[model samples]
Each structure stands twice: as structure tokens, then as C-alpha cells.
Target: MRLFFHTISARKKLVFLLALLVLPGGCSRHKSPRYLYGSNCGICHHGGEGMAGSVPPLSGRIDRIAATPEGRVYLASVLMNGVSGPIRAAGVPYRAEMPLFRYLSDEEAATILSWLSQQGETKPAPTITREDIAAARAHRISAGDVADMRAKLDLKHPLP
Candidate 1:
């Protein structure tokens, strides 16, 4: 009887250890910065009015922006920082100021950008790279960069 009890106890302990190893601690597993965006940013950026401005629809913007190098670079910069003032989408003008989100890490930025690029928007699939991210970062860009980019694009009144 003693031998059988010990064996069962050992088996129970082993199972408990395995469970601990596989199951991460509470809440920490989902605490990533990406989670912040999905839960919080998505609250508004998804389909609702985000920050008083209709969040730029991410559906088709991804493909339209990823097809060209300039577009990809432009998007990465916008994500790292934010854009404000007048901007346009699908030819419609939007006038709003997008708050900058600088808390995201480089990897997080890359992931968000890649996901945005592929969000059922583009046809061939977006091909955003870390290199493109670096280039966009190098643009020394900021919310203010929108002014210059818009001027170059001849967007006298771009949308948000």
C-alpha cells in the first residue's frame, strides 16, 4: 500500500509540474504592446470613431500603400509617429489630428505594419520589411512630416 501511494503521489507531482511549465502565469501572457493596440486602439481604429476622427479605414489602405516603396515607407513612418492635419483617403478628404503612438517597440511597429499591409487590402500580399521600417525611421519624420509629404503629393488638404 505504501509503495502504491508513493507512486501515485509522484505521478501527481509530475503532472502538476508539467502543467505549470505549459501554462503561463496569469495576465502576463497577453500583456504585450500589440495587445494594447488590439484591445484599446482597435476599439476606435477598427470601425468606430477613434479620437473624434473616423479612424482611417485600414481595409484597402494596406494594399494601396504597400504596392510601392514610397507608400510602404510612408506608412511605417506614420505608425511610429502619428499624422495630423488634412489627409485624404480613396480621394475623400479628412481633417483630423491623429495622436502619435510612440510607445510601440521596433518589433511591434514591424508587426503592426506587416499586419496592416496584409489586412485583406492588397492583392499580392504586402511585403513590408524591417529595412523599410529603418528607412522610414531614418526619414527623421514626425507628425510634422505629414506637412512636407502632403505638399509633395500636392495634397493641399489631406485627410486624417
Candidate 2:
């Protein structure tokens, strides 16, 4: 090891050390909504379950919810405006304070929601689009409004 180090020029040694550092970061980088979700949402959502679960469990409910036009818009509203106060999920109640992620671009919001809807099952899920996010943004409801929306959403069953 000492002999190999001595044989290399200073520039080569620096290059080798830099490559060692950069490779792991490059390889570890997460793509698309995984990064968006993990970085922005993974903390409390814990893989998207409020446990009473992010905003409710992504385990099975997301695909069901996204199947409906109203549900899709509600979801986009939650993401853009966020919801506070108490809510029930999976039969239990949770009072998490979700913050608005309005800073995300329309494309990024669509990507995140699309990823969320696809989580935890093999069933094909509907895709959220930039247009969906944009429309939600246009409405600009408050957190209280979304909190009230939780009840009407009827998230427990898939809507026709």
C-alpha cells in the first residue's frame, strides 16, 4: 500500500481520492419522486402511512383514491395547500400538521403524486399530471378547508 501510494503522482492521488468520494454519492443518488418523497415527506409519513397513518396509508388507499376525479383533485389540493388539524385514517385518528409543498414545480408535484399513487401494490394506478397540479394550485384553498375535506373524501372505499 505504501509503495503504491509513493509511486503515484500527487495529482493522481488527489484524483483517486476524489473518485472514491464522488462515486458513492453518485451511486446513492435517488431519482424522481423517490427523492422528492423521501427528502420532503418520509419523516412523519413513514412510507405514506399516517398509521392513523403522510396523509393516510399509501399501502392500498392511494390507488383507490386516485381512481376518482374528485379524489385526485383533493390530493393535489392537499399537496399544494397542505392540511392541518385532526383527521382519521384506517379507522384511527391522527392530528398531523402537514405543510404546503407549493414550492415544487407543477411537473415535480405531478411526479410526486404519481409515485405516491403507485406505492405498495401491483395494481395499475392512475397518473397525476402537471395539469392536475396546476388546476389545484389555481383554487388555492386553506389548510382548514382541506381538513374539512378529509371527511367528504371517503377515503376508506374506492369511489365509482
Candidate 3:
């Protein structure tokens, strides 16, 4: 009887451990960053590699840009407003335009940005808050200027 009880307890512990490992963020019901990215960004970014001469790949790039003050503003503006016209993303020229994501609330935008910064990363990336998004929102830069903002910065990798 003792051995049987111990075996059951061990099995239960193993099951619980497996459960924790499987869930992306400890099994919360809230939508995951991956899910949000898939719904909102995947069609354009396409597994973060993006389509050639069109959408820019985001997985390895956003956070590096976000780390800077001016870059932060540009990134925020790009997310909030949409960019159009000729642009180079990660060194590739993309004539396609990016549409505004103004529909996303500040919180949702933060979530998306946070996710973008951490793609393919093993650990969590630095978090961007709704307040950060709000501050960028305050700038109210136009979509055209936001797209143009890219010209000012030296992007290590360009987005198409």
C-alpha cells in the first residue's frame, strides 16, 4: 500500500511538472504574445523573415531600435500610425506600405512591441509599458513622417 501511494504521488508530481513546462506563461487564460503576433503581424511579417521587397522581418530588429530615444519614437510612430512610400527595411528596398495599427489600444500595442522585441529569444525581453506607448502616442507624428523617420536613423538591418 505504501509503495502504491508513493508511486501515485510521484506520477502526480511528474504530471504537474510537465504541465508547467508545456504552458508558455504558466497557463494563464490571457492571449499570448505569439498569438497576438500571429493575428496582428504574421500576415505581413511572415514568421518574422517577412516577404522579400515588401514587409520587413521583425524578429531580430525591433528591440535594438527601441533601445534608443529617437528610435523609440520612430518605432512607436510606426506602430501607431502606418508608414507608406519607398523604404528600406534591413537593407532590402520595399515599396509596399505599412498600414496604421491605431486600432490597437496602448496596452495591446505594448504587448505587441514587447513580443516583437523578443522573437526567437529564450528569455523574456525588456518590457515596454502602456505608458511608454502613451508617451509615443502624445507625439502624434503623421504616418508619412514616421515612414520618413527611417531615413534619419542608421539601421544595422533595414526593414523592407
Candidate 4:
């Protein structure tokens, strides 16, 4: 009886461990926006401050870009499709190829964008919803096309 009880306890422990490993958002910060940003965007953006002359800063710029409907759409499109070629951000020119994050789920993408929008010096951060990401996904375009869209947006702080 003692041996049987010990075996049952061991099985219970194994099951609990497996549950923690397999359950969604369980014992894992992967679903958190900060973690997502760190693993995905942070590599280049470097805490959203960017790497001067190489990667454009996202801190102050992201909020301003998200201020308008068109800007919001552009942001969603950029996140889904990525962007390339020469572009101006924060009045500085950068020519880098941002990788497409199409693998990210709508919820994860939205969360990351929304979290990023809240970063920097801007107050009253803009929200990027899953619907926004879904809409961008519906109209699939190339990364280069996303850069073109960025040029056309009438943002408060225009991206040249």
C-alpha cells in the first residue's frame, strides 16, 4: 500500500509538471507583451530606443504614428508585412529591413503593438486591437509595399 501511494504521488507530480509546460500562458511569460517584444522586436529596436543611424527609434515615434486612423492601419500593416528600404523616423533616415512577424497571432501582435504604443514620451497611448491586425492580414502585401504605405500616411510626425 505504501509503495502504491508513492507511485501515485509521483504520477501526480509528473502530470502537474506537464500541465505547467503545456497549458497556455502557464508558468510562462511568452504571452506577455513585454516578453514578446523582447524576444521579437527588442533585438533590433533595443528597448524601443533603437540603434542610432541603423535602427530607428520606436519610443516617441510609434505613439505619434498611431494617432490617426491611417497611421494605425499603416502600423498594423507594417507589423504584419514588415518594411524595407530608406525611410525617415524621428526626422532621421534609416535604411533597414524589418522582418515580417506574420507568424505572430493576431492577439499577440495586437498586444505587442499596443504595448509599444505605450512606450516613449507620448501620453495617452494608442491601442492596437486584434481586429486591426486581422484587417491588415486580410489585405496581404509585400514588405516593400508597407514602406510605400508609410510614405503616404498623413501622420502628425510624418515618415519621410
Specify the highest-lDDT model's number: 4
Better model by TM-score, 1 or 3? 3
Clashing pairs in 4: none
Model 4 ranges off by over 4 Å: 1-5, 9-13, 24-30, 154-157
**Candidate 4 at 104: error in angstroms?**
0.8
Q: Model-by-model lDDT, in order?
A: 0.61, 0.76, 0.72, 0.83
> What TM-score fits each model?
0.63, 0.71, 0.70, 0.84
| Candidate 4 C-alpha lDDT tens digits along 15-87 | 8678867886653345688988898899999888899999998887777778778888999998899999888
Candidate 1: where are CA atoms >4 Å away? 1-37, 47-53, 150-160
How high a TM-score does candidate 3 get? 0.70
> Which tens-of-lDDT digit does each residue in 48-130 have in candidate 2?
76444435565566666788788888889989999888876666567857889998878878888888888836367788899
Q: Could you tell me which 10 consecutive residues in candidate 2 have the lowest summed lDDT?
A: 24-33
Residue pairs with colliding backbones in model 3 are 89-158, 89-159, 89-160, 90-157, 90-158, 90-159, 91-158
Error of 2 at 134 (Å): 0.4
Structural RMSD, model 3: 8.2
Kindly provide the TM-score of model 1 when superposed on the true structure, using C-alpha atoms: 0.63
When superposed on Cα atoms, how far off is each prediction in RMSD? 6.2, 4.9, 8.2, 3.3
Per-residue lDDT tens digits of candidate 3, residues 18-127?
Answer: 87787765432367777777878887887888887667778677877766666666777787877877777677777758887877778778888877877535355656
- Give the winner by TM-score: 4
Model 4 score (lDDT): 0.83
Expressed as tens digits, the lDDT of each residue in 1-160 for candidate 1 is 5575566777787886787776764333345544645754576576322343455566556656666666676677676667877766655656746665556555566666666656654567777776776666666666867645755544432323
